[model samples]
Target chain A: MKPAQFDYADPRSVEDAVALLQQHGADAKILAGGQSLVPLLNMRLARPAVIIDVGKLRDLDYIRDDGDALVIGALTTQRSVERSELVAREHPLLAATTRYIAHPQIRNRGTFGGSIAHADPAAECPALAVALDMQITVVGPGGARVIAAADFFVTYLTTSLEQDEILTDVRVPKLTPGTGWSIQEVARRHGDFAMAGAICTLTLERGRCAAARIALFGVGAVPVRAPEAEQTIIGQEPNAALFEEAGARASAEISEPLADIHGSSEFRRHLAGVMTQRALTEAFSRAEAR
Target chain B: MTAKRDVSLTVNGVAYSASVEPRMTLVDLLRGELGLTGTHVGCEHGVCGACTILLNGQAVRSCIMLAVQADGAELMTVEGLSEDGQLHPIQQAFVGQRGLQCGFCTPGFLMSVYELLQHNPAPGDDEIKEALGGELCRCTGYQSILRSVRDAAARLRGEVPAAATEGEA
Candidate 1:
């Protein structure tokens, strides 16, 4: 399938891209990597009147260690993130989770910011962003503003970003020392989108869970942060039974689990619980080893 | 119709220039305009890896990328694997290993393997599988393809003579 005829512009700078977005507004679509958008275009599902190609904005392709966090540019390809030594040393969770994305071919063209902006609930990037409390920066005609990961995702395939705004970068805080993390998902194939997934980070103090964060995706419109599940684990010694209880809490917290031809809502809920349990179990062992 | 844009790029060591519409995919430009039909179009959407090729030495799905995106990039296609009517070592390995049945998915596999070998001259089985994970092969159940890549790796690493693999075919 061929895409519908559309006017194209490859802006060289972020300011020029923002101006184009401000000009075309909702009628234009930003083409970064085009791993996801091009497929939609070929299918005629996204027929934007204008396409703003930001591929020329080389300034937006970087991975910087900003002391407390890693600042990744919007145009940074997933392949770069996967292979970054800084990411592997500082945030191994990011490197491990990125491998769950489609494959090398797609990762070579898919941008880290594009995945976050696309906000696909089944995607690993958004779930990891929510779990780690990452910050997203968006640039508009007014200037740039940072949005909390919790406020960034609005719903399925939707973000809080305005039509005239372009996501510039994301700030991922480094994991505190002695913190253990795991990202687990159940997908039809190794590279396919997950049916349901869970991301967990655990910090243990004196053999007791000091802090726990749990996030679930592919079961809701947005990545669901399991506060109740985290509460169940905090201040308690992690055991298989405790992990089971937290998993149940996480599954029960999903208000609206998505259902499709791949799996029913109930099945996804079950999978979310199973994934959380597995992730927590693994995270706890790693934390104890730390 | 959208206005056509001029693009000039190097493919398989040859420089080419062409005018393409903004919506025309890189695969379309290669097949229809440049007449490089080695890169087949399976799923125009990015799902199938049949349109895979090397852009700037990295393997990518050409079907999802616009022709204008390759304006200044160097590319490699399946047709570029051979030189002076001789099969490349990778192609020879695939033939020896019987990596294909219908052969429609061979070009994509070859391009992907070429990139994998270029980066990792001695990749393990898991590494090979990971590199080719996106490609879908309905025939041969991928076992033979896996063997072919392993053989290709050995051939490229000089562990196996190219003629030895070709003789096995």
Candidate 2:
């Protein structure tokens, strides 16, 4: 299959790319790693009039530790983040999550920001962003502004980003020194989109859960935060019963979940609870280890 | 009509330049424009690894990559595996181990295994499986393919001979 015809532009600078987008408006599509966009283009699902190839923008390819957070440029490949010693040492959750994005070859070309900007509910990076409370920066005709991950994603394959805006970087805070994190997902096959997934980070203080972040993907239009579940576990000791209760609450709170050939609504809800339980258990164990 | 873009890339150590449509994928450019048909096309989407190639020393799916994106990049396709009319060690191992049935996915597997062996000369069974998992082979039940990779690793490391053993075939 071949992609539909589109005008191509290779921008050397972020400002040039944003200007191109502004000129074309919604008719333009930003090409980053092309792992996701190329497939969409080849399938003719995305028929953009113009494609702005920002993959060559060296200015946007970097990973730096800025005090409390790791600021990753939008053009940084997923493989680079996975192999980064800094990421492995500080943001182990991000490192573990990148491994689950896709097969090795795909990860070699797929970019960190592209995955988040694509906003696939089943994708690991977006879910991790939501779960970890990462900050996203976007540049447009208006100016550069930082948006919280919670506000960035509006729905599946849709984000709050404007047509003229280009995602510049993502800032993911390093995990707390004593916190435990786990990413668990269920996919029909390896490298396939997750049928249901859960990302959890837990901080235990004096034998009680001081802070917990629970997020579910493949269960809603957007990656869903389980506030009820988080509320259930905070200040409570981590235990089998508490974890099960939190998981059930997390699943129950999602009023509507996606359903298709992959799974039925009921099955997805059930899987969400199971995945959440598994993530919590694993995360608790890691907390103990820490 | 879309404007054609001029792309110059080195494929298998041979530099070639072509003016392809902006929408033309690298796999199409390789097979149609450059006549490098050793790379197969399957699923045209990125799922199938039939069109896998080495783009600047990393194995990537060419079907999803545009030819223009590879401008000035060094690429290695399946055709690059052999020299002087002799099969590459990986190819020889595949044949000796009966790793292929239809031989459609061999190029991609070879390229993938090529990179794997470069990084790790002696990968364990799980590592081998993980690397090959990116590419799909409809035949051989995967056991022989696994054996072939192990054999290739041994041969590449000089732990085993390069020639096929006697099978009375």
Candidate 3:
């Protein structure tokens, strides 16, 4: 399963990497951690004319605490995020979600920005990005621009990023005070892609839900935000019954759920509901504890 | 055909330089060119951890990483585990614990365990399982492998004598 022959370029800087992208357009693929892309290359599913290796862009490998937000470089490995004490203290949901990724071996090399840019429907990074409303920054010939996480992912393996743009960094806002979050997924194996998953955040004001965010993955073309389900939880006091209704709404909201050997469309739809219910239940308890 | 690129890296404590195709994976370079065949190849994709190795002290799937990408990096393969023709404590623990049947997945497991024990000398069972979650073993049902890791951790932590775990291999 060797990769097909392809020219390679090691770009030292972000501008140089963007220039190469501009030169090759879509014919070239950016090689960040190469956790996902390299496998596709090995199987010849992805035969890029050129591979622009951005591994040497050391500047884009960092985790910075920027007051209200955590600015993570696109090249920051998932393992780094998993081990970051700042993330553990400030954004526990992010820290916990990072562990739900493949495994330590893959996480050691998989870049944060690469996962978000790859936009795998079953991946936790994109769903977490959407659930937290993270901001993604991409650099191109026209300089850098930021895209809301909601607008970042367009479809399966596709993002709003232009052909010549390289995702530079992601800005994850710290969890609001009294906000509690949970991520839950069911995979065939511990490290396999989830069959279906849910990520939710709850903020309780007084005795009612003041803010609620819910996102589902592995059941659609992209990680989807369940606004209808979220609306069900926002104004109501969260209980097991309320969570069940919201889960049903979230499941119903999915117009098309992906089906494969792993699970049927109906099974995934059912799992989406179950996962949403479980995540909401856990989040509610955590919010109450806070 | 793509033009070959020059790559220089240190593997198993020795420096090596080679010219390889850009599409060549690090595992291929290690096994085919460098002759470190201890790092077996079960799946060329990243799913199987047969080609796992240490790159700059981090366990990674070498099959999914390009050889050129490993340029100027320090690496450790399964072949590097033993010292002075002596089996490493982890390998001894595997031998003692019967952690293998076919032995094809052992090398990847050993490298992964090496990294794990290096980071956490006293990892609990859950920690060991999480660290080894990527590796796939068809034989032994992973129970023996888990025992081997626990034994290896004790051996490394100086709680158990390495000689006491020596088995007839």
TM-scores, chain B, all models: 0.93, 0.94, 0.94
Q: After superposition, how far is residue A144 of candidate 3 from its true place, in Å?
A: 0.9
Candidate 1: TM-score, chain B only: 0.93
Positional deviation of B24 in candidate 3, in angstroms?
Answer: 0.5
By DockQ, highest first, what's the ranking? 3, 1, 2
Name the regions of candidate 3 deviating beyond 4 angstroms.
B161-169
Q: After superposition, how far is residue A4 of candidate 1 from its true place, in Å?
A: 0.6
Pairs in steric clash, model 2: none
Which is the leading candidate under DockQ?
3
Ranking by TM-score: 3, 1, 2
Q: Write the per-residue lDDT of candidate 2 for residues B116-167, one digit (tens) a residue.
A: 9999999999888777778998876688788889899998988865456356
What share of the reference contacts survives in each candidate?
A: 0.89, 0.72, 0.95
- Candidate RMSDs in Å, in order, are 1.8, 1.6, 1.7
Clashes of each: 0, 0, 0
Docking class for candidate 3: high
Q: What is the C-alpha lDDT profile of model 1 across A1-290, one tens digit per residue?
A: 88998999999988999899888888899999999999999999999999999999989999999998999999999999999999998889999999999999999999999999999999999999999999999999999999999999999999999998999999999888778899999998788999999999999998899999998989999998999999999999899999999999998999999999999999999999999999999998888777
**Model 2 chain A worst lDDT run, 10 consecutive residues:** A187-196
Task: Specify the highest-lDDT model's number.
Answer: 3
Provide the fnat value for model 2, as a fraction from 0 to 1: 0.72
Query: What DockQ was computed for model 2?
Result: 0.77
Tens digits of lDDT, candidate 2, A1-290: 78999999999988899899989998999998899999999999999999999978977889999999999999999999988999998888999998888888899899999999999988999999999899999998878999999999998799999999999999999888769999999987677889999999999888899999999999888898999999999999899999999999988998788899999999999999989999999999999999
